[model samples]
Target: MADLVSELRQRASALGFDAFGIAAAEARPDLSEKLQAALAAGWHGDMDWMAETADRRASPVALWPEARSVIMIGVNYGPDSDPMAALARRSSGNISVYARNRDYHDIIKGRLKELAGLLSRRTGEAVKVFVDTAPVMEKPLAQAAGLGWQGKHTVLVSRQFGSWLFLGAIFTSAQLPASEPMAESCGSCRRCLDVCPTDAFPAPFQLDARRCLAYLNIEHKGPIPAEFRKAMGNRIYGCDDCLAVCPWNKFASETREAKLFAREDLREPPLSVLLALDDAGFRALFSGSPIKRIGHGRFLRNVLIAAGNSGDRALLEAVEARLEDEDALVRGAAVWAFAQLADGERVRRSAEAHAAGERDAEVRAEWAAVLPEVV
Candidate 1:
């Protein structure tokens, strides 16, 4: 069995996984208390679903009691070049590293299943695989599996892989031996906290999702909050400010996962081009990626916020097109974008057009305020 475990690790490495570990499947006894503490403090914000599945998220054993082992693997996804420099060009939208090319879920999940099948064929055991979903605490499980210690950013970080790895796990009924845990190497570095544009982290190992640009752009369903809109700059989809600033990333290597590498079109894509996408256009552009899950309304809302922040006159036409969008959320965001770039006269006209017929009270109020002399 030990030799089998060793052989599996070799296969995973050949399959492009940077690190692999096996964890005995048992409920993480300490996790429930930590989850209760986080939920009690409201660190999860409006992510009410996290609270809904409280028991399962706290431990894998509670999710599937029959599971006896979890095989966790990490795939390095770092690009060869710097991902942060794209931010300096104000006219372009900064997509996060994870979403740069093909979605991680598809890439990692496919490989995890192949490994699961190999294990099942050898041991005649039932297995299920997951990446980024299911009721799994992948980071904590990865830590327990000895893949690596969870870093200050609360992500599983391996010294061999730095912080640029995508994770996946296969749960099996076979009684596999577990691996040893890795010690933390974060030491005294506070660079991740210092780099946050919205001050999203209250402390090391804690994240306030409300203030996280990733959450704001992707998870939160409503308007981009007035306070954070300006700070968002041109980050249309998600923010990588904290991840990009980690000193440990100096050891990061370019990924060999061709599917996970950044597409030239996604790197610093024009804000105008993204803003021009309506529902059909959005569906066409993000067909196979996680971005498709965000839907056009929420995505366009983020783009409009970026368009407002771009401070570039070139995107005014795209902003103008969204002014008449049927969705009040998009129209409200468009009104804000126009206010950022257009003169007072243009703001007045756009605001008035939406003010009378807009059924959404919040959007109407936003339009009223955007009007030049309405104050």
Candidate 2:
């Protein structure tokens, strides 16, 4: 079993996985309680699937009765440039590092399958593979497998990779020797918590997704909540403050995977370019990237929120162009952004022109609310 684990780690490394470990499937019995506590607090926000899949997620055995051991693999996706510095360019959109390149799911899943096939061929054991798409709680499982411990921000932190790992897992019927779990190394560091623009962390190791900009910009589908708009700043896609501030990252090197590196155009896309994106343009720009999943309307909604926060009057024309957009979600966001850039006279004129003709109640409500405050 020890030899098998060693062989598997070598294969995983060759396949571009930076970390590897094996754990008995039943190692962590505390997952169910932790998951229930978060769900009861409604910290998950609109991600109802977390609640729906709670049972299967809490235990590997629950999801697969025959599972005896789990193999956890991680690929380091460290950025070469400073992500937080990009915030100063308010006229441009600050995309989170993870989404600037290819979707990790597409990259990690195939590698997981190849490694799983090896374990099956060697031991004649049944195997199942998963990336982030599965109900499997990869973080806790990764910790139990000794890939790394969960940091204060609840993201896995490796001594080798910091918070830049993309996790994958393989469940097998063979009972492999388990690796020793690493202890949490974070001592007095509060950098991650203090740096959050939205105060997403309720406590150490706890996150309220509703207040997280990453959740608001990515997972969220409807209009962004009014409270978080200003905090959103120029970050149109996701927020990296919590992860980028971690002291552990000092040990992490830039990723060897060229596919995971940020594309030049997406590194800090101009707000003007983003605001002008139509559905076809959005599709073409984000073609194989994870940003495409949100669809153009939600993408524009996020862009407008960032535009409102930018305070760049130069974006006023692009913002006005979306006032009569096909998607009510986009039109509503455009109205809010228009108020931020235009003076009272222009705000009043635009409101008068669009407010009466606005068919969507939400869009009309946006015009009505901004009128008294600005006009």
Candidate 3:
């Protein structure tokens, strides 16, 4: 069993995974309770899938009863430069480091399937592989498999890889030796908590997804709350403030995967350029990227919010162009962005011109909400 585990690690390394570990296919004793507590507290926000898949996510054995050993792997995606620097470029959209290139789901899933095939061939056992698309409780499983500990920010933090790892797992019937779990090493560190722009963390290791910029910009489906727009700064797709502040990142190495390198165009795309994208243009720009999953409407809504926070008067024309956009969500965000960029009288005049023609109640309300109170 020990020899098999050693060979598995070597194969994973050869396949380009930065870290690897193995664990028994049993439930972690505390996972079900922690998941229940998080869902009960409403910290998951509109992510109803967490509630729906709670039972399956609680245990690997529950997910695949015949599985006897689980293989957890990590692929490092550390950025070459500080991701926070893009936030300061107000006129540009700040895409998260992970999403600034090819979609990790595709990249990691393909590699995981390859690894699973290797395992099956060697052990003559059936195997299954999963990336982020499944409800596998990957963070905890990674920790249990000795990959890393879940940090105070609710993300896995590796002593070698920091918070930049993209995790995947393989479940098999082979009874491989389990690696020892890693102990939490984050002693007396509050940097991740203090660094959150939206105060997403309610306590150490507890996150309120509703208040997280990454959740709001990515998973959220409706108009962004007015309160969060300003705090969002220039972050359009996902935010990286919490992860960037971690001390363990000092030991992190930049991703060796060429496909995962940040695209120059996506690294700091001008708000003006992003706002000009029609559905076809949006699709063309993010063809194989993860940002494409949100579709053009949600992507535009995020861009408009960033435009509103940009405080760049130059974006007023771009904001105004979306006032009558086909999507109500985009129109609403445009209205809010226009109000921020234009003066009170100009906003009022534009509102009067568009309010009568506006069919969406929410978009009309945005016009009313941003206008100065009548004397």
Candidate 4:
């Protein structure tokens, strides 16, 4: 059984998984208590889903007790292009590299299932595959499996793959040998913490998802906070400021997976063109990409914020045009963006137009607030 486990690791590596490990399929003794504390402190913010199923998420045993071992895997999805270059081009809306191609959930989940199927055939055991879709805490599970230690930024950091890797896991009833846990190597290194534009990391190994640009741009459903707007810069879809500035990523290679590489069109798409996308147009453009999940309203809301920060009067027309959007979320964000780009006269006309015609109370209030004195 031990030798067979060795073969599994080798096969996984050959199949392009950068790292592999197995862990005993049980909850950490302290995980539940720590999670309860984190939740009580309101660390999850607006993410009600995490709080809804607190029992199942805090413990692997509570999730599926029949599982005897968890096989963890990581695939490197390092981008071929420079993640930082797009920041200088204010006209281009910066899409995060992980979202540039086919969604990673689809990519890594398929690979994890294939590996699980192979293990089932060899060991004659039942196996279940998971890739961040389950209640399993993937980072902690990966850490237990010896894949990597969780770094200060709350992401799995590997000595080999660095922080530029996607994680997946497989659970099996077979008793596979578990690997020794990796020790934390980020001692005295504050590169990730120092690099954050919004200071999203409140403490080591803990993240305030509310302040995270990934959360604001992707997970967030409504208006972006006024404070973080200017700080957001040209990052329209998701922010990579923390991940790109990590010194450890100097070791990362260009991804071998063609789908993981940045699309030429998406790399630094013109903000004007992105602002032009209506719901149906947005759907067609981001069809296979992860950005599609955010829907047109939230996405265009982000683009409006970017246009406001652009300081380019050229994009003001597009920003003004969205004030009449059917979605109040879109209209309110447009109100905010126009306020940012608000001039002496443009603010007056917009406020007059919306104050008279705007039906949504929230949007009307936002329009009335756009007066130059208030703006």
Candidate 5:
């Protein structure tokens, strides 16, 4: 079993995974408790799937009853430059580093399937592969498999890769030797806690996903709450403030995967350009990227929120162009953006003109809400 585990690690490394380990396929009681507590506290926000699949996500055995061993893998997607630098460019939409390139699910899943096939051929064991698509609890499994300890921000932080890892897993009937779990080495670091633009962390190792910028920009389907809009700044797609401030990142290495490298265009896309994208144009721009999943309407809603926070008067025209946008979400965001950039009289004038003709109650409410603020 030990010899097989050693060979598995070597093969996984050869396949381009930065870290690898084996964990016993058993119930994780601690994970079950934590998940239940998170759900009870309503910390998961609109991601109801987390609550729906709680049992399946808690234990590997529950997910795959016949599986005897789990192989957890990590692919480092660390950025070559400071991701936080884009935050200062208020006129540009700051896309999170992970989404600035190809979709990791596509990249990591292919690699995992290839490695699983190789393992099955050698060991004659049946195998199944998963990336982020499934509720397999990869983080805790990765920690149990000795990949890294979960950091204070609740993201896996590796000594070799920091918070820049993309995780995947393979479940098999092979009874491989389990690796020793990594110890939590965070010590007294509070950098990740302090750096959050929105106070997403309720406590150490606890996150309220509802307040998280990443959740608001990505998973959220409606208009962004007015409370978080200012703090969100120019972050359009996802937020990286918490991850970028981790001290462990000093040891992080750039990803060797060519497809994971940050695209120059996406690193800090101009708000003006992103705001102008029609549905067809948006599809062409994102193409194979993960950003395409949100579709053009939600993407534009995020872009308008950034425009409101940009404090750039030049974006006024772009924001105004979206006032009559077919999507009520987009139109609502445009009303808010107009208030942020235009003077009191200008905003009132525009609101009066649009509110009379606006049929959507949500968009009308946005105009009404912003009118008093500007006045």
Candidate 6:
């Protein structure tokens, strides 16, 4: 069994997995209580799937009773430059480091499938693989498997990789030796919690998805709440404040996988360039990237919020152009962005021109909400 585990470790590294570990299928019996607490607190916000998949997500054995051991692996995706520096360039859009290239799910899932094949060939143990599309809780499972400890900010942090790991898991009926769990190493550091633009952390090791910009920008399907708009700044896709400020990152190096590196165009693309994208243009530009999944309406809405926060009057023309957008979400965000950049009179005038014809109650409400402020 020990020799078999050693062989699996070598194969994982050869396949480009940066971290490898194993855990019993039922190693963490406490997962159900923790997941239930988060759901009870309503911290997951609009991601209803978390609640829906709670039973299966409790542990590997719960997900599949035939599972006897689990394998966890990580691929480091450290950025070539400080992700925070992009925030100072207000006129440019800032994307999360992970999404700046091809969708990682596509990249990692193929590798996971190949590795699983190797395991099945060796032991004839039935294998199942996951690259985050399922109910299995990869982060906690990775901690159980000793890849790294889950940090205070609720992301995995490795001594070798810091907070920049893309994780995957393989489950099998083989009773592989479980690795020792890594202890929590954050100590007294509060940088991740303090740096959040929207106070996403309710307490140490606790996250409120409702207040997280990443969730709002990426997962939430409606108009962004007014309070979070300015806080969002120029980040059109996801927020990286907590992940980049980790002290453990001092040991982190840029990724070895070329596919995981940031694309120059996506690293800090100009907001003006983003605003000019029609649906076709948006799709073509982000063809293989994860940003394409948000669709054009949500993309435009995020860009408009960034434009409003930009304080660059140059974006006013583009902000105004979105007022006629067919999607109510896009039109409403344009209203807010226009209010942010244009003078009071132009805001009132634009409101008068468009408010009457706005059939969507949400868009009309957006116009109504801003009217009183100008007067």
> TM-score of each candidate?
0.95, 0.97, 0.97, 0.95, 0.97, 0.97
Candidate 2 yields a Cα-based lDDT of 0.90
Q: Please estimate how well model 1 matches the true structure, expressed as its whole-model Cα lDDT.
A: 0.83
Off by over 4 Å in 6: 254-259, 373-375
User: In candidate 6, residue 114 scores what lDDT?
Assistant: 93
lDDT of 5 by residue, 1-375 (tens): 677677878888887888998888883558888999999999999999999999998888888888898999998888888889989899999999999888989888888898899889889999999998888998888998999999999999999888988999999998888889999999999899999988999999999999999999899999999999999899899999989999999888654562268888998889999998999999999998999999899999999989998999999998998998999999999999988999988988897788888889888889879875432
lDDT of 4 by residue, 182-296 (tens): 8888899988888888888878888888888888888888788877888888898888777777777777654464226777788889999998987888999998888998889
lDDT of each: 0.83, 0.90, 0.90, 0.82, 0.89, 0.92
lDDT of 3 by residue, 1-375 (tens): 577678778878877899999878883778899999999999999999999999998888878889888999999989888998888899999999999888998888888898899888888999999998778999998999999999999999999989999999999998888889999999999899999988889899999999999999999999999889999988999999999999999988654662258999998999999999999999999999999999999999999999999999999998999998989999999998998889988988887888878888888788778863520
Instruction: List runs of model 1 lying over 4 Å from the truth.
Output: 254-259, 372-375
Candidates 2 and 6, the one with greater lDDT: 6
Winner of 1 and 3 under lDDT: 3
Can you write out model 1's per-residue Cα lDDT over 63-89, one digit (the tens) per residue? 888789999998888766677787888
Q: lDDT order of candidates, best first?
A: 6, 2, 3, 5, 1, 4
Once superposed on the true structure, which residue ranges of model 5 sit more than 4 Å away at CA?
254-259, 372-375
Higher-TM-score candidate among 1 and 4? 1
Candidate 2: TM-score? 0.97
What are the clashing pairs of model 3? none
Candidate 2 at residue 313, lDDT? 92
The number of clashing residue pairs in model 6 is 0
Candidate 4 regions with alpha-carbon error over 4 angstroms = 254-259, 372-375
